[model samples]
Target: MLGVTDYGAFVIAFLLLLAIPGPGNFALITATGKGGIKGGLAATCGVILGDQVLMWLAVAGVATLLAAYPAAFHVVQWAGAAYLAWLGLRMLLSKPGGAPRTTRMDSGQYLRQTMMITLLNPKAIMFYMAFFPLFVDPVHHQGMITFAFMAVTVAALTLLYGLVAVLLTHHLAERMRASPKMANLLERLAGACLVGFGIKLAAMR
Candidate 1:
């Protein structure tokens, strides 16, 4: 278990966190729909990498520093909100049949886009900082080793969850592809949901 207080409990908590609907999940689904399995896997990698960056930063006390500076927190929060809204607006305004699409080969684009989305959310850092302590063994903690283990666990969980999502989304995408109008409507709905998510994020205190 290393520095983990209870490995089983930690895994359960982490899985629950992942189950919560969020921007990253939506991005993964959207990428899968557009670029199939390859794109979903790329986006999954992007999410993992982005999360690793934040996890290490949290361990380095960046979360504490941000907490001490309200302005800095607000800046990141607003930036993420704006980015989501902008992407949503673009999707909303695009013509039904003319919207740009990507293929399975566009792995890089999916990866970067999802990474950017994950990185811009300030709340994610707060969550990581809070989350790590809950499962950390204060009496026998191994510092970096403990955190590293937790990071790897989360990443593995994410990859597993993402694969399942990709398979489901790909199947749904196939059905939608045969119905352009339905696809267009669903695309519009996704855009609106993105906008709603942004507003909700921005409104959070």
Candidate 2:
């Protein structure tokens, strides 16, 4: 059985990490702004799929294997960290919301970006790798049972956060579109948050 403290810590850490706007969050917001609630929700589903893949991979010992090989693990971690840093920089530099452009978001783009964003995120991989071991008492519960619990918890959280972001973007789309200054500020804040998270992940033992 998982300890209450472990579960609480996992929830807090996961939610805090997700709260920081990154490529995934920005993508969701942009989709909401462009296509309203329905479109945003659809894109969010793609994100959920990407997360689900990672969750399973973690439970399968992929993260453990990567952790075992120091050189290879460092290579993967650095690459992921660099990718996240690049995303943060890009978000910081991007122009604010503008008039709805003719460029329509397609399913392909949605899936591709969602997968890339989640998979490329070293911080996220590290998080699950670190988090799952805490609550999992494989001696007490089956490995699959623990993994299933964690996966379901994460999926539900994703849905909640995605919907919250979608609603916020939808509610303020027009105002956000008009305020370049606010957009730039949000971009900077989000970028800083990602960079900070990356640093924290990199520093972890």
Candidate 3:
């Protein structure tokens, strides 16, 4: 487990997190619908790479530095809170059914677009910076090795989730169209969760 406590819970938590509706999910669904399996797969690759980048940057920097200057950790917490709250508000205000935005036939285009979105994704970094530490056994932490293991675990989980999402989205494309309300409800719920997380993170201090 590489210093990760409750490894099973970590995996389960991540898998459940993936189940939540979000921009990345929409991008995958849209890519599949517009460009088929190839495009969806390409987008999936993009998401994995983007998440890897975000994960390393946060894990190596924030987690490392924060342990030293614990006070400075508040900055990250505040930033995450503001960012999450903003995103939640935006999602709440957005006309449900709206996605992060996409539609491309070229695999490369889908990859690049999704990668960029994931790179700038608020939820990605917020979760990494704020949520990751919860499971870290600081006393048993193995520095980079621990972070690396977590990163790999995250990447592998994302790949599995993306593959399943692509296949399911492709298969459910028609039914999804028929049940647009379900998508809207998910968005609303996600927005609520984001806001709740933001408040909770802010209060943790």
Quantify all predictions' global Cα lDDT against the true fold: 0.86, 0.69, 0.73
RMSD of each: 1.6, 4.4, 6.3
lDDT string, candidate 1, 33-102, tens digits: 7888999999999999899999889989999999899999999999999988877776677577765444
Candidate 2 worst ten-residue window by lDDT:
94-103
Give the residue spans of candidate 1 off by over 4 A. 101-105
Which candidate, 2 or 3, has the higher TM-score? 2
* Cα lDDT of model 3 by residue, 110-171, tens digit: 88757865665444565698878888888888988888888899889999999988888778
Candidate 1 residue-wise lDDT at 165: 89
**TM-score of the candidate numbered 1?**
0.95
- Give Cα distance to truth, residue 37, candidate 3, Å: 1.2
- Residue by residue across 15-89, what tens digits does model 2's lDDT show? 897897566786677567656787778768878888888778776777777777777777766666676576567
Candidate 2: regions farther than 4 A off: 1-13, 20-23, 78-103, 137-139, 179-205
Top candidate when judged by lDDT against the true structure: 1
Question: Any idea how many clashes model 1 has?
Answer: 0
Q: Arrange candidates by TM-score, highest first: which order?
A: 1, 2, 3
